[model samples]
Every structure is written in structure tokens, then in C-alpha cells.
Target: MRGKNVLITGGARGIGFGIAKAVAQMGGNIVCLDSLPEPVEEFKELPQRFGVKTHYFRTDVTKESSLYKSFKDAVDTVGDLHGCLTAAGVALDKPFQEHTWEESRRILEVNCIGTFFSVQLAAKQMEKQGTGGSIVTIASIAAQGNTCPGQRLSIYNMSKGAVKAFVGPLAVELAPQKIRVNSISPGITRTPMTAALAIQYPNLVKMFDRVPPLGRMGSPEDIANAAVFLLSDASPYVTGADWLVDGGLHAGTSRSLKDPSEQ
Candidate 1:
């Protein structure tokens, strides 16, 4: 990854920031596009900390105009983009019947539409550069199946499910250009977003504690590790694949009906 410039949406915090740090650690220059008014302190310190170039632009992925301008600015600042991760997304936890049309629209706009355009802009840049690049989108285990039983995420699930489905065809389309597109579906990761969710609904914490076969919630680094792999040259042949980093949560229940001795 050394000398490569990777673009990361939502790079101001959480899983995005973790991936940015991982990229920097691998000696890659980073260009961050987030809706934050300004870059955070840690993000600001990346250049000196990692001895690599770093740039941040305030970008709202839902609006193609905003995304286009920010993307142009990012390319002007960082040079050719070799990798991208579309991680800007939102979540809602209301029951399907109770969900308002407005609430549904917001989640779809931010998660689905946002991811769509971000990938488009990144691919455009990579295509123009004529340099094969890797693109990774953030999906969720919720899209695969209901990981959180009681917590309703109908709209959120639909949005991410759209993302998971979108990757395969895009991968095939981009293959001719040597651009790889894939997604990472994370389980219950400990991010500020999930922390707030857990606080609002205490049961979520218990679910996080018990559900994963790994016996713990995931960390930003856990997901970041996978993103780094997909972004780096190590995964040249890997594309159009949705990597599930859910600690075996999606594999099925860890519990058995009877003990081995009883059997």
C-alpha cells in the first residue's frame, strides 16, 4: 500500500477511521471524505504520525454535486486514487409498522444512495487514472439475516441488503477495467453509533454479549483488518465478494440441542 492514495468516506470516525489508520500504517496516503464540519484531531495528525499524506474534505454522499466536488478536490490534493471504502451510513431501529415514510427515506438516502454515488465517483476516478483500483463498501450482517432478533431494522436492513446485492454486478462490470468491488458485512461492531444504540435499548447490549460465537462484540479494528486486505494488492483476484466479518454470527447458532455426552 505504500505510496498509494486511498479514499475513505466517513473517515472521520468509527470503522472508516479505523480503516484509514490501518491504511496509513501500511504507508498509504489517505483522502477522507466525511460530513463532519472539520476533520477530527486524530485525523489531522495522520501525516506526522504515519509519515504519509492525508487530506479531509467535508462531503455529503447523498448529493452527487457535493460528492463530485469533494471527490475532485480529494483527487487534486492526493493525486490518483488507488483504493476506496464507502463506509458512510446510518441506522434506524423502529419496527416495520411504526416506521414513517420520512424515516425510511433518510436511511435509504444515506446508506443506499450514499454508497451508490461514492462508489460511482471512486470508480470514475480510478477509471480515468487507468490504474486498476480496489473499492470496498460497508454492508452489515443484518443484510445477510437478522442478527438482532428483537431490534427491528427493517429499513436499515433493506438499505444494506441493497449494497450487498449491488456489489456483485458492479464487480463484474468493473473487472474489465481491473477495478475490484467488494463489501464487508460486519456483525455487532463497537462503534459510537452502536454504543448509542445500546444505551437507548439496553437489551441490545445483552444481545451483543451473547449472540456472537466469538463471545464478544467486534471492534473497529476487526473490520478494518478486512478492509485493508480488500484494498491492498494482496487481494488482486478477489472482487465482487461480500466478506462477512461477523465472528461466526451469520454461520448460525452456537448452541446445540444436546450435549456431546448425552448424544
Candidate 2:
């Protein structure tokens, strides 16, 4: 990732920030776009801390107009856009029956629609530069997990499925132009957005012990590393693929362990 100019949506915090920092450490410039002003203000120090150029632009991922402005701002400043990490998104955890019309719409508008618009804008910018680029998204294990009957996350799960469908064809459509599109599906990760929510468990560590063979939740760095690979030349032949960084959670999604007596 050295000498690369990268832009990440929803990069103010969480996995986006982690990705930003990771790339910065590797001698890559970073431009982050988000709806919140605080993230931009706080991210101002990343340049000094990571010894790489870093900038933050405020953009609402849900709105094309706002996203356009934000992306344009990044282009003007960064000079060359090599890739995009469209990780900006919103999560709605609600019962399907309790999901108000507004809530459902808002989730899709940001999580799915937001990703689509960002990818289009980034692809166009990269095409104009003709430098060939990588576009990665922060997807979820939910897309594949819904086959089981554990969690009731219908909207989030469905949207991720949509993200895969949305990114694959574009990967083909943009292949001729040299732009690679990919997604990373992460399981539970330790980020601010998930901190409080995951804390609901009395014994968080103990509870997580029941998770995959890894026996714990993931970290933003785990997903960030995958983002870097998808964005870097290392994965030049990898496009339209949803890379799973779920600590083997997907590999052992269901349990078939029988009682000790039966064994």
C-alpha cells in the first residue's frame, strides 16, 4: 500500500478508522468521509501519529448529493484515488414485526444504498484517473448466518446479501476498466459501536467463549487487514469476492456435538 491514496467511507471511527490507521502505517495516504463532524476533527492528528498524510471529509453515506460532495472534496485534496473502503453504515437491531417503515428504510438507505452510491462515485473517479483501483466494503456474517435460526436480524442480514449482489456485477462491469470490487464479512468485532451493545452480557468474555473455535470476538484490525489486501496489488486477481474474516465462525456456524454419553 505504499505511495497509495486511499479513501474510506464511515472512516471516522470503528473498523474504518482501524483500516485508515493500518494503511497509514504502511505509507499510504488516507481520506475518510463520514456524516459526523467530530470524527473529522478527531482524525486530524492521524497524519502525525501514523507518519502518513490523512484527511477527513464529512459526507452522509445515505444521500448521493452529500456523498458526491464528500468524494469530490477528497479527490481535490488527495490528487489521485487508488481505492475506497466503503465501510460507512448504520445498524438496525429490531424485530421484523417491530421494525417501523421508517427504520427499515433508513437501514437500507445507509447500509446498502449508501455503499452502492459510494462505489459508483469511487469507480468513476478511479476510471477517470485510469490508475485501476480497489473498492472494498465492510459487510457482515449475517448474510450467511441467516440460514440458521439463532438471531432475528432480518434487515441487516438481507442488506448484506444485497451488498454482495450489488458488488459482484459491478466487479464484472468494471473489470475492463481495471477497478476491483470486493467485500469483507466480519463477525463480532471490538469497536466503539459494538462496545456498549456487546457489554449487555454479564460475563462478556465467558459468553464469547461459546463463539467459534477462536473462542472470542474479532478486532477491527482483523477486518482492516483484509481491507488492505483487497485494496492492495496482492489481490490483483481477486474481485467480486466476499472475503470472510470471521475467526472461523462461519466454518462452524452450526453445532452437532452430541452428549458425552452418546459419544
Candidate 3:
């Protein structure tokens, strides 16, 4: 990925930040976009530590205007993009009956609509450059369905399902342009967002452990490593595929069949 300009939405923190660091290590210049306040210290040290150029733009992925302008500015600052990671998203879980219209709308706007525009605009820029690029969106295992028994996330699940569905069509549509489109479906990962959940509901920690057969929750670095692979030259032929980064959760939890004494 050396000399490749990669744009990462929600790159200010968490998995997105992890992806940024990994890309820098691979010698790729980075354009980190997030609605959150700039991580001035981290961004400053990135170039010096990784020996690559880095730029950050505050962007709200929900708005097409904001997204397009940010993409344009990012391209102008760093040159044409070779890859884009659409990691900006939100997760709000509530029972179907209790969910207010406002809450459901926010989740759909951020997780589905925001992702849609982010990928669309990035592909447009990549198309204009006449150079094929890779685009990765952060879907979730929730798209499959809500796993935790007590958790109510009808709307959140629906939002992610939309993202999972969007990737296939977008990938096929952009195939002629050589712009690969893909998504990552992560399980219960230890992120800032989940940290709050853990604090609010201590029992969720235990619930999360039981879901992934690996006997542990995932980390930002875990998913970041996967994203880097898709963005790198190593996966030129890959597109339209949803990569499950949830450690064995999607495959079903492991279990002991019987005791040795029984045999």
C-alpha cells in the first residue's frame, strides 16, 4: 500500500484508528475523516512515527453534502484515493414497542444511510481518478439477528441488515470500474461504544463471552487487521463479500460433545 492514499471515515478513534495505524505501518498515506473532534496528538504523531503523510477532516457521513465535500477536500489534500474504509456508524438498541421514532431514525441514518453515502461518494471519486479502489464498510453480526436474549435491538439489526444488503448490489455495480466493495460483520467487540454498555449493564460482559466460541470478546485491532488485508494489494480479486470478523460467533459456539468416561 505504499504511496497509496486511503480515506478512513470514523478514523478518529476505535477500530477506525486502529486501521489508520495499520495502514501507516504499511506505508500508506492516510486521510482520517470523523464527525468527532480531531485527535490532534494522535494525528500529529502518525506521520512522524509511520513516515507517511496524514490528514484529518471532520465529516458527518449522514449528509451527502458533508460527505462529498469532505471527500473532495481529502482528495485535494492527499491526492486520489486507492482505498476507503467506511467505519462511521452508531448502535442503539431498544425493544420495538419502546423505541421512539426519533431513536430508530437516528440509528438508520447513521448506520445505513451514512454508510451508503460514504461508499457512494468514495466510489465516485475513485471512478473519476480512473483508478480502481477498495471500499470497506463496517457491518455487524447484528445483521444476522439479535443474539443476546435480553437485548432489544430490532431497529439496530434492521439498520445493519440494510448495510449487508447494500454491499452486494454496490459491488456488482462498481465491478466494471474495478472498484471493489465489501463489508465486515463484527461480533461483540470491546469498543468505546460497548464500554458504555458494559458499564451500564454489567451482565452484558458475561453475555458477550458466551456468544463467541473463542471464549473472549474481539478488539479493534482484530477487525483493523482484517480491514487492512482487504485494502491491501493482497486482495485484488475480492469484492462484494461480507467478511465475518466475529470470532466463531457466526459459525456457532463450540461445545463439548461428551465426557471421555462415557466413551
Using lDDT as the measure, the top candidate is: 1
**Candidate 2 least-lDDT 10 residues:** 254-263
Across 1-263, the per-residue lDDT of candidate 2 in tens digits comes to 87899998888888888888888877889988888876735467767876788877778888778888888888898898998998887776556798887888888998899998888889899999988899998888887744222345678788888887777888899999999999898887777766655555335433443565475678888888988888999899999999888777778731422335523
Q: Is candidate 2 or candidate 3 better by lDDT?
A: 3
Q: What is the lDDT of candidate 2?
A: 0.80
Q: What is the lDDT of candidate 1?
A: 0.90
lDDT tens digits by residue: candidate 3, 1-263: 89999999888887888889889989999998899977546667888998999988888888788888898899889878999998888877556799998988989998888888888788888999999999999988888765644577788889988989999999999999999999998888887878878877778666786567786789988998899999999999999999998888887753421335523
Candidate 2 root-mean-square deviation in Å? 2.9
Once fitted onto the true fold, the runs of candidate 2 whose alpha carbons sit more than 4 angstroms away are: 40-42, 145-150, 199-206, 253-263
Candidate 1 TM-score, true structure as reference: 0.95
Cα lDDT tens digits, model 1, 88-190, are: 9999887789999998999999999999989998999999999989999999998895746567899999999999999999999999999999999998899
From the highest TM-score down, the ranking of the candidates is 1, 3, 2
Best by TM-score: 1
TM-score of every candidate relative to the true structure: 0.95, 0.90, 0.93
